[model samples]
Target: MKRIGKWKDRLAAYVDGTSGEKLDQGVICRDDQCTLGKWIYGEGLAQTGNLPTFHQVKAKHAEFHVNAGQVVEAVQSGHQDNAHKMLHEGSFAKSSRDV
Candidate 1:
């Protein structure tokens, strides 16, 4: 089993709406949990203040990260097409260098 770390735990909490802490009205603090929380919430400008609901965050996190993991695995296993398809479906814009 994968050993979940503190960041992952916090991310799980945020994603599940179980964090019990109100969303910070300002930028997420630079603490460890906040740093990871921001990532799991998806990167953005701090001033935008347009945050998604817990359910949306959780679903997108799972979709992107899980598909990204599959893409990495496929590339490592010599399945370039599979990786490309995953990236395309995930709406990740591939630069010329990435091709």
Candidate 2:
């Protein structure tokens, strides 16, 4: 995955529940399909297989100001090891206030 800079804003809108029509814009992928949308809507993975792991996903959520419910959803849907890593070593672990 590219640096988190690209899809940051779109993911923020998604977690904020204020995406509105921007929800149609999707994540920034080579095929223009929305990776986050697939996860949020349970739409299954895109053909490209460029899925972000739980740590990366949650880190971006924190970095972009995502909400608590979205964070919980990420943990529920994420890989166990990735979620563990985020809980133990990533931003999610550091920001007790956010949790």
Candidate 3:
């Protein structure tokens, strides 16, 4: 969760013009690439797939990535304000909590 929070912070920095790290929408769109995602798809699924909440976690995790990618798309399109807003209180923020 801390790593995931840092990922969002990196995007926020990019959108704020404070960091030079290049944002990649394509990469952010792949939820399964993150550590949490890896566990969800691998050990987590194997260990807890039968749990009722497992499916919800999986779905929310996927949505979080989609929301994150949308924020990156806004940034890449020259919409820093929109991206920042998203990082704070829009789809991105919602997913951050949901996930």
Candidate 4:
């Protein structure tokens, strides 16, 4: 227990990196596919998988959209968004006060 806690504290970045699968390209929602609003309002979910997906799947989909979108945007613009959505309930979204 102590060792696990220590690992969590000492290697936050490294630990998070290994938790998700990498992809060559990210899925972007278009037209009927985008659902950031539904996710934020808790009306739906957003999850990702190894295979290609068009819309939100589970609660994690929103996070995947954010993460994948950031990756795509960064690769193209050389910058990443402040929020990184890797998995479901991975990290709380930054509050307005935090910004």
Task: Count the clashes in each prediction.
Answer: 0, 0, 0, 5
The reply for model 2, stretches above 4 Å from the true place, is: 1-71, 97-99
Tens-digit lDDT track of model 4 for 19-93: 343333344322124444454344432343332443433334444445444444443453323223321123322
Tens digits of per-residue lDDT for model 1 on 1-99?
A: 122244334433443446674434122222223343465445533533364664454454444444434544554566666656645543322211121
Instruction: Indicate which candidate wins on lDDT.
Output: 3
CA shift of 82, model 3, Å: 1.1
Clashing pairs in 1: none
What is the TM-score of candidate 4?
0.26
- Tens-place lDDT per residue, model 2, 38-69, is 45334333433355664454444444333322
> Order of all candidates by TM-score, from best down to worst?
3, 1, 4, 2
After TM-score superposition, what is the CA distance of residue 16 in candidate 1 from its true location, in Å?
35
lDDT of 2: 0.40
Where does model 1 exceed 4 Å of error? 1-52, 90-99
In model 2, the Cα lDDT at residue 88 comes to: 45
The 10-residue segment of model 2 with minimum total lDDT is 24-33
Task: Give the per-residue Cα lDDT of candidate 3 at 71.
Answer: 91
**How many clashes (backbone atoms < 3 Å, residues ≥3 apart in a chain or on different chains) does model 4 have?**
5
RMSD of each: 15.0, 12.3, 1.1, 12.2
Model 3 Cα lDDT, one tens digit per residue, 2-78: 87689788878888889988878999899899888999999999999999899999999999999999998998898
